[model samples]
Target: MFWKKFNLNKQYNILYLDYNATTPIDPRVLDAMLPFLKENFANPSSTHYFGSNINESVKTARIQVANLIGADETEIIFTSGSTEAINIAIKGVAENYINKGKHIITVSTEHKAVLDTCKYLETKGYEITYLPVQKNGLINLNELNKSLRSDTILVSVMYVNNETGVIQPIKEISALTHEIGALFMADATQAVGKIEIDVDDFGIDILCLSGHKMYAPKGIGALYVKKGIRLPAYTHGGGHENGLRSGTLNVPSIVALGKACEIAEQEMQQDAERIVSLRNELENELLKIPETFVNGSIENRIYNVSNICFKGCDANVMIGRMKNVAVSNGSACTSAVIEPSHVLAAMGLSDDYAFASLRFSLGKFNTKEEIKSVVEILKTELEFMNS
Candidate 1:
């Protein structure tokens, strides 16, 4: 009976504040991608009329993705997602630049993708220096400077910490990396589309991003390789994606990603202003609860994320008690593990504080009313926990 009057297409009941995990695909993106999936179902590599048209669509998508990050069209390489991109960037650099150096530099707060890749390299005898972060989740530049060695081949840092939303000083780090002749690579999955990214301006030699994080369909991502940077192919076969990657292109998803990037470039500023206001309101209200603390650098954080530690409260219990709200203690990638957040732990947070943290990330579709309701839900759940 309720569904008789309610339009399911536009209606939502869950107070979703987990945009960091992934965003719901935009309708516009779906609209743009449908043709590729249905009528234009042809291989881009095929020597036929359908293939020719599809190839043009793929090229257009590539340019759209490239333009979002201020990269040349030739520099974009589509991948399954950021994880794959990270693997390509890290392993490619390690393999190609091994002659130049067997050392890589990264921050302790980097996503597991970068850390695990470096760890794998460690098995091959490559040295990895994981620079620690200060209590505010900011890496120590001086420590970084000291860690750079003549043999350092790559320095991988994320543009934003997925859990804490703390933005790294990418430009400065890029400068430092170049000074040592090491390539600078960034996992920008959490930063791209949420913020303005100019790969050239940031001096980032390689950048990776996921379309799912920015209102596109999942399983679509792209890596930006600055021109002239040589990375060994991530996959071997048909030599697609300029021979850097080889696969039959997922044309529908690629088209969706391109459309999402186009929308992001056009609406980022407006979306940021609105989302930040809602995020601030929710955060301020939630922090009013006694013993609650904000995690990481408040000033340097991105507009849409607020990671808060509810002292003496169990994050899992609180989440379970809060009805109609969707939030997380940390990254979805690490949610299966019942462990404290590595990002918070890397910033010197105690085990209890790390376990008590919850990440609230807002998105374009969320409303101020939703933020208020989430705050109220949190308040009720926290009070119950305290009692």
Candidate 2:
């Protein structure tokens, strides 16, 4: 009924299961954004009355984001998206803590935003230790402990593997990072709205999340910096976002992200419950195919995703065949690369298995009928491929 109020005519034409790639904007979030785009378009930095009112709205949006993650309003820094937020957090730490240490630790399976940023830092004289994950797509705690050194300035890990839906032990990882007096940062782009995250409880020094991954429009995201942690200015301008990221605020998208966060806080549990059931139904049915198996730790994965490897089948070809269905082989960010997923490679999957994998990520908007249709489509496609 909630979705009925919106025009979902185009969405119904495809069986979209790629929530991790991005999500459709919620109508409620869109409604909250429209006024900001039109009548309330004044710049938040302007000194006029209209600008002051718009500033108040931005303040409210900041509070909404903070509340969702159990952080203070002052800790939130709006950015273009997770990539920008990640660049600020990782590079900022590298720059500010250069005198303290030149070493950093992150998983081999981190998103390219984190990996590529760390690589850039390496060119600047920082030593990066990329810890490998287990076959189950989980990092070894002992290895992580051994990797930590006195000169390690930061340990950055993603809260969830976007491809496999595998969740890391954030609390445990943060505890270990703190033991060695290093900061912990989690790229929570894929986990924020799907799971409950208390940055303080997890001992996170820095965290980044993207709005587009959680039913808000693209080009909006926020970074959480724990109080008392200071990072150098990421952008030079009017000292906006606590002088970290300076630019004209994206008012409409910010409002949309705020509304999405508010709605997520209120409805996440129920949405997860329904989505997990549909995900299970889809996965269980798909596993009936020959040589098919899940790619990650079933016990440790998020409820909405099922990354399965269909042996002897090429994922790209299968995806091409399923014209009416939308699934993915891996993160959309790396889709342009002509290779198997690095995440799967780090998990010790063979190239064949990695290329054979498909990620079905369900969301609140997906339905049982859609799941069944997707399952049937995949079944027929696989049968034809095998034939």
lDDT of 1 by residue, 115-175 (tens): 9999999999999999999999999888999999999999999988899999999999999
Best by TM-score: 2
Question: Candidate 1's C-alpha lDDT?
Answer: 0.89
In order of appearance, the predictions have TM-scores of 0.97, 0.98
- lDDT tens readout by residue for model 2, 307-333: 999999999999888887889997778
Off by over 4 Å in 2: 1-12
What ranges in model 1 sit over 4 Å off?
Answer: 1-10
Q: State in Å the error of residue 187, model 1.
A: 0.9
Instruction: Report the CA-based lDDT of candidate 2 relative to the real structure.
Output: 0.93
